[model samples]
Target chain A: MEIRSMRFKANASAKLADAGLQRNLRKAKGKFVDTRAVAIKEIDDFEGTRRAARDLRDRVLKDLDLWLERFETQATARGATVLWARDGAEICRHVVDIARRHGVKKATKSKSMLSEEAGLNQALAAAGVEPVETDLGEYILQINDNEPPSHIIAPVMHKNVEQVADLFAKTHHKPRKTDIPQLTREAREVLRSHFLTADMGISGGNFLVAETGSVALVTNEGNGRMVTTLPKVHVVITGIEKVIPTLEDLSLLMRLLPRSATGQSISNYFSVLTGVKQPDESDGPEHLYFVLVDNGRADVVGSEYHEMLRCIRCGACMNHCPVYQSIGGHAYGWVYPGPMGSILTPLYAGIENAVDLPNAATLCGQCSAVCPVLIPLPELMRKLREEQVERKLRPLAERLALKAWAWVANRPALYALGTWFAVRYLKWLAGGGDRIRVLAAAPEWTAGRDFPAPQGKTFRELYRQRQP
Target chain B: MRVALFVTCLVDLMRPRIGFAAIELLEAAGCEVVVPEKQTCCGQPAYNSGDRASAAMLAKKTIAEFEPFDYLVAPSGSCADQIRTEYPGLLADDPEWHGRAVALASRVHELTDFLVSVAKIEKIPGAFEGSVTYHDSCAGLRSLGIKDQPRALLARMPGVELKEMTGADECCGFGGTFAVKFGDISTAIAAKKCDNVVATGADAVVAGDLGCLLNIEGKLRRMGDEKTKVLHIAEILAGDA
Candidate 1:
């Protein structure tokens, strides 16, 4: 979550891309962008749906407290224990306390990023219990011990099948197997045993349906179902922002989530778990606990970034983000990457700690345009930059440059003169070539690029001539 | 229609031909074009660099200069997109400035986009005998949705072959201050863009924003592939296509 050397690594990655074709990013550049293109073409009114979903979320955030209360009340009355946690430590302690009280030896988990954020596995392990991941991606990432997850949807996106096979080899104590099918089959076999023997089940809530106190999980894998049904105790860990006022409010999000995430018309499984199983039910967790972790949502409640809480965790913003496509999430140096990560990481962690988030975007507005719930990501980034400046976090040179430009810009004559002189100086520097062959300290342009001086005149000069 | 040109700082300082190209092309399509000397940079650099007060100062200056025009047009898609999409949000703090920012933002347009979408220009008077690839600037393509306007004009050029480049919509690494602050990364992206242009084997690379063109063109020079020249879309549309 705290990446000290992210900017350094990002700079290094950039250097590599300049030195070569950037083979690592290129391998998926064609693949990810192209696949998304095909997938986008398949959805009719995808843009329309995007706008509607954005509007829906805007409406939701306008009165977040009302929705959250409605959800908690409904869920608590539905035979489920609803717990509120203001921070990760609290959430971890709560979950651990439950396991300790129930004497839980092993727990099967269905890929919860919230769990990852809460550091559930480590706490559970310290309490002498094992929390085994069941979702294919999370399970893969967990066994590898590389880190938590780079992507919200694709935890192991950085890992290819080869690395996965290697991870399995070390874990299973066998020779390396490179085949994709073999790797998956081995994981499936290994997880199947855990599911059967697990005393408790843990899963992240996709949507906390307020009307029925029911939690809806949309997963491609059936692991979630097995985790919940096979265990005596089921725990649904989610953010406070995941609460929806009604099932109807949640239905709109259901349509937007899958299409935005993996481009599916509908996920394979849409499971709705309401509290615990009934008395007459043959199978299902007898005890159910819903843990709502604030993490940092409360701080942003009335702040300018409250809309960020409206995120449904679909990973749409990340998938289409240009920056994420390049460094492939690792460079974000945070659990989340891309547009959402850029905005959220700094807020979740401290801005001073994650100084790079504000600078991550190109300010292209693509993230906002594609955002299902219209979060003004670029604008938010600009605000973060302002926060940095207000805090005096940026270098004095950059701040002074802005101040000087501001003073000159407010005056027409000075701005025009400054423009004229700069252009003339450039022309003189280029000396009839139109190309500045050599550039100074501002070598960012000249380092790997060049600046073309206009042919004898600047646009302002030409316009002045036309005016005269 | 009477139109006022907001020639961006890069276009003004680095490439004046893009301005001429825009003027000639717009005039050829039958619109009265005026270049206002009172205009300055769109304040994107300061704005993006977290100087809101300065950005607001520049935004106020821009509003004062261009608010009376029928429409404010710019050759760069990135600048036009900024005026339309970002200016209002940036100035929302001051209610009076907010209205002015919104007013100025609403009427601003990218040159080719204005020429097509508003003025309804069918063809520009131009022809060039060469194959060229077009790089879709991120702000223009994604921000303003000026996808077909530039391409539509290029596709209809008389003698030019409008070949497509791979990853044409990717950033050219000229992200204002991003170029300087994050140089190593910006150059890498620029190198990728240069390769796409070279891969097309086109004589020139064309784009809506001069900023992107300059970045790509510079990389082409550093990479020692001078055969691939960089041209603004307006220049190509203004020429003998």
Candidate 2:
């Protein structure tokens, strides 16, 4: 039932909360930020490009079903089977059926968060197929039997190098050493062998070019290459929202995806595989299939939160978010931790179980500012809060308090009297906003900080003197 | 311009200097400033805490009280943002009140944005010498889009040594109600703010919103490090220049 992991919500004690979920985020934020700056700095018209890209995404999303249908037709025409799935169970069934038909024993995967959303690897494993992760980050988390990913671009962003090394050691049944380079080397060797021997490769598509029916994957390492090209059977599981009407629409995203993600102009490997390689194609998967997973996405369209589908998974939203920057993604208590995750997690899961997700935001609007598609993130999150209220998930106490406030607010006299009490004597009662941190009401505000005493004179009181 | 002051409930009850500073600076700018006495809290607390009924009533009350002015100004970015943004949202269900909400939004301004973009004030006309850093309050920076306005003014001030701190725009953990609801983490983040302030070796810190400043200042004082002082952007601008 826990969509995400529980983290330090509010550590009253400072020391316990200061520990880094992943050392790399702390050690590498400067590098990630700098690389992105350098990339955009090279492109003189990056902002213009971002605007064009945003407009393109807007147009595509405006008629997502149309593009998705076009993509399916185009992809199916190109000799790749495209199956539509309405929910996670359906998506998992499609993937599992593919493996069963192939008699697949080991299914190697690259980084695809949709697969995580569909819980594909576990579904495959439950069906008795060993699903191996080829991406280094995915491989690390997979071997540990741990969570899928913490951040979008960098899956295990919260794990420091030491934890990775230890995970490597435990999974490999070797002695633990907290060395990052050594651990990476170990992962590289272990996953390299799996890449060569895998029966099927299940990769996630960043964008499926509707015109060409080409599945585009942007990866840092070359594993997406191995996962898609090496296996005998290649399957891609992605949300229907990932389709673009044409390559031209994709080109706009190409400029935006890398800079916003990991701060790179382009990822190390950008591979385009069009239908199963031709008869004489040197080396590629022979059986090609794409499972297009809708899974509640259709419900999001034209709704208040339809914009959530515009995410290109840049991780910039998480990088710049104050809450994500501090506690890391895990504390958000969900798979997609930052502002983007807040909206997505609630929608994917029931809003009731994941109620805290909406409250995680400061409503800062920075996530929206940095979003390449310009998704109105904070606004969408607020809309979710509104929905949560309409659904009556909020506690009765809070509901009643708001009603009482509304009643007082409706009566000018009652509100004025309350203001009078606050302006006149609350300072004395609060002892100059002193040691009243723990009070009967507003325990949240008074915790850890004290309020300053209000002056006996309200601004109006002073203004009345001048006029009188 | 005749301006009506919306001194947020927090300032009206806890910190009056912020309200006074806004008045002094507006008066200095040659505007006729008026504080409407019947105005109560802007109802942000109840609203943000998921109490829409109370928030809606307060939003209506706020609109009725300030709709008479040519401009509605506030010293806090968060408050102004709430009035400008949330008020319209609250009154959306009521066609009559929606018009009032829209009217208030059209005239509403956070102090720094209005000061720099409208009143067009430059030169800190006051004397204060020492290194000072700024924390971009969330509402002012993200919601109100006032990032460079205050910083631009601060950089131009005479005798001020401006030192940029890392993550200057990061939230200081004073999310108004959030700070109280999530105190442990609030204090944890506030302690980081204290650390950032100490790192600058700056004599003081300045911000456009008092809510964050108070949280930062309270932690600093409670930690008993008086070397750093907190000031609202208006106080610095209204300096005895």
Candidate 3:
């Protein structure tokens, strides 16, 4: 939630040098791309499903206020409390108040990106109520003094098995265990008691079904079930954009979400809760709270970046991004990372502070291609870069160079003369070698590569000579 | 078809042979090709840098320069994609050039795409004997959907064996100004790309975009691995290598 995206380049440079992290990234690189490809290949009409999902999301976003009001009405009618928060601070205030009212000394939590975005755990801790992360990955992060989640789906993806084992060993004061099943069992054993004794449970909403007045949660781990079912009071915190018009729309997104996420046709658990448990009902929470948080999403609705609201947080963009693959997620230096982070950070955090986020991309378009909702990430990044240029946020040298180049490019004769002179200058710089190790303007271009020496003559000159 | 060649700035100044090869290939395919002298840069550096004004200025100049031809083709996919896909949007706000920009966009084509889709050449006019792997420039491969077009043309060459490299579609880190701006990250990405190209043991690496070729080739040369030569798709198709 903190605006650290200004440090993205420096963070990436540091990340690139960490061999352990690089090895982790390399090992996990192609798994997402390959699995998603296989899952997509099995579906006969995957594109049709994507289109359906996109259309439904677009429709919901078009009249988001109406949908949110409808959802609130339906949810309230179903014997659930619906509360709206204008921003992260407001959400934290409401959460802390609710926790204190419930006499909640500790709260169990499922993996929730909304909670991360709001810095809710820190807020809860400040309010004197401990928040126990129930999801294994999140639990590891929480136990490690709340280090950031690197990837959305795989929070501790930056850590290897050995690192996790070391973390668990240090936390539990037990002998180090390296085997995954044993480690998982250890985590389960440690978390089982917290799940039973926690006074409250908090989870993130995957989708808010407007028609049925239910909140949908899809997770691979059993912890979401435990977090929702064990505590007397249950709270779901999510963005305002998660509302869907119908269960049918929810079904369309379901087919795409898990497949695009971890290549599962469906996650292990899909919980659709309409309301709190009735007097006669068993094995459910006594109260439910739906907190809708609007940080900056309302401003994005009609803006040029409205399409970004369609994201379902499947993270297919991050998984397929070559830049993300190279440097890993921490380099993004935010709650979100990878391609989606590049767009969202600038918008959510001030663009002035996060200008480097958009410029970091190579305009590869891999993120958009794999995006189930088909957000044109590269084009949006370009737009953000243009905003920077218009704001004069770029280096003075670069801006002046671009302006000078554009001036010459607009005139044919000037461009011709410029190219001829530039080619000759480059040839002289090369010193008759086929490769030039350095250039006067850009020493960085020659840092790790040899620039090809320009040919002695420009093509315009050659063409003129050939003309009969 | 009478085509006007928009020899991109990099090709014109750094690699004129690519421009010559493009003209040779077009003529051999039974199309009358004219090299337009007024054409300069495609303005991608400006466009990608978020300087839309310059991008628009260059786009309008390019549109007017090649307006008379039935087709406007370029050897670089990044440049061609700029003219074909981005020009209309770049000039959208301009009352004078908006219509012309959009009209010119329809006539614009990357050289390989033009040869395969428009000219309908049965085969490349000459033979290239070597095992060459192809690197797909991000702009060309994703923007123009040009994966099969170059491969389809390359398949027609009698003696050329296409040894595919792993991660060929990955970016070569030469995102124009990005190479200088994010130099370390760019070089790191290019290092990996060149590693993949070398792993294939191909005698040469061919690509449709010269920007990517130059980046990959520069990295290879820097690493002292000059066994694998880099050539544009035009040079291979023209058999001028």
The candidate that achieves the highest DockQ relative to the unseen native structure:
3
Worst 10 residues of 3 chain B by lDDT: B119-128
For TM-score, candidate 2 versus 3, the one ahead is 3
- Cα error, residue A175 of model 3, in Å, equals 0.7
Question: Against the hidden true structure, what lDDT does model 3 obtain?
Answer: 0.89
Per-residue lDDT tens digits for candidate 3, residues A321-342, read 8788889888887788998999
- For residue A328, give model 3's deviation from the true position in Å: 1.1
- Give the fraction of true interface contacts kept by model 2: 0.47
Model 2 interface CAPRI class: medium
- Model 2 alpha-carbon drift over 4 Å, by segment: A1-25, A28-31, A173-181, A410-412, A420-440, A455-457, A460-467, B50-53, B85-100, B121-129, B155-157, B239-241
- Model 2, span A1-468: residue lDDT tens: 246422335321332345664244556554665576677776778778777877777778899878878887887887899898888788889889988998999988998877877777778889999998888888878877756576778877767777777777778887787776777777788888888888999999999898888899999889899999899899988888888888878878988899888777788999888897787779888889998887667888877788788888888888877667666665666557788888888887668757766776667676777787888887777777767777887667767766776677567567767766765564565666543444446555555555444557765555556674
How well does candidate 3 match the true structure in TM-score terms? 0.98
Give the lDDT of residue A51 in candidate 3. Answer: 82
| Standalone chain B TM-score for every prediction | 0.96, 0.95, 0.97
Place model 1 in a CAPRI quality band: medium
Task: Kindly list the per-residue Cα lDDT of model 1 for residues B1-241, writing each as its tens digit.
Answer: 7888888888777777778888887787788888777777888888898888888778877878888888989998888877888889878888998898887787999988898888878766777778988888888897788778877887787778888887677677778888877766677768777888899989888888877887887888889987777788887777722
- Score residue B11 of candidate 2 by CA lDDT: 67
- Stretches off by above 4 angstroms in model 1 are A1-24, A30-44, A416-421, A424-438, A453-456, A462-468, B93-96, B121-123
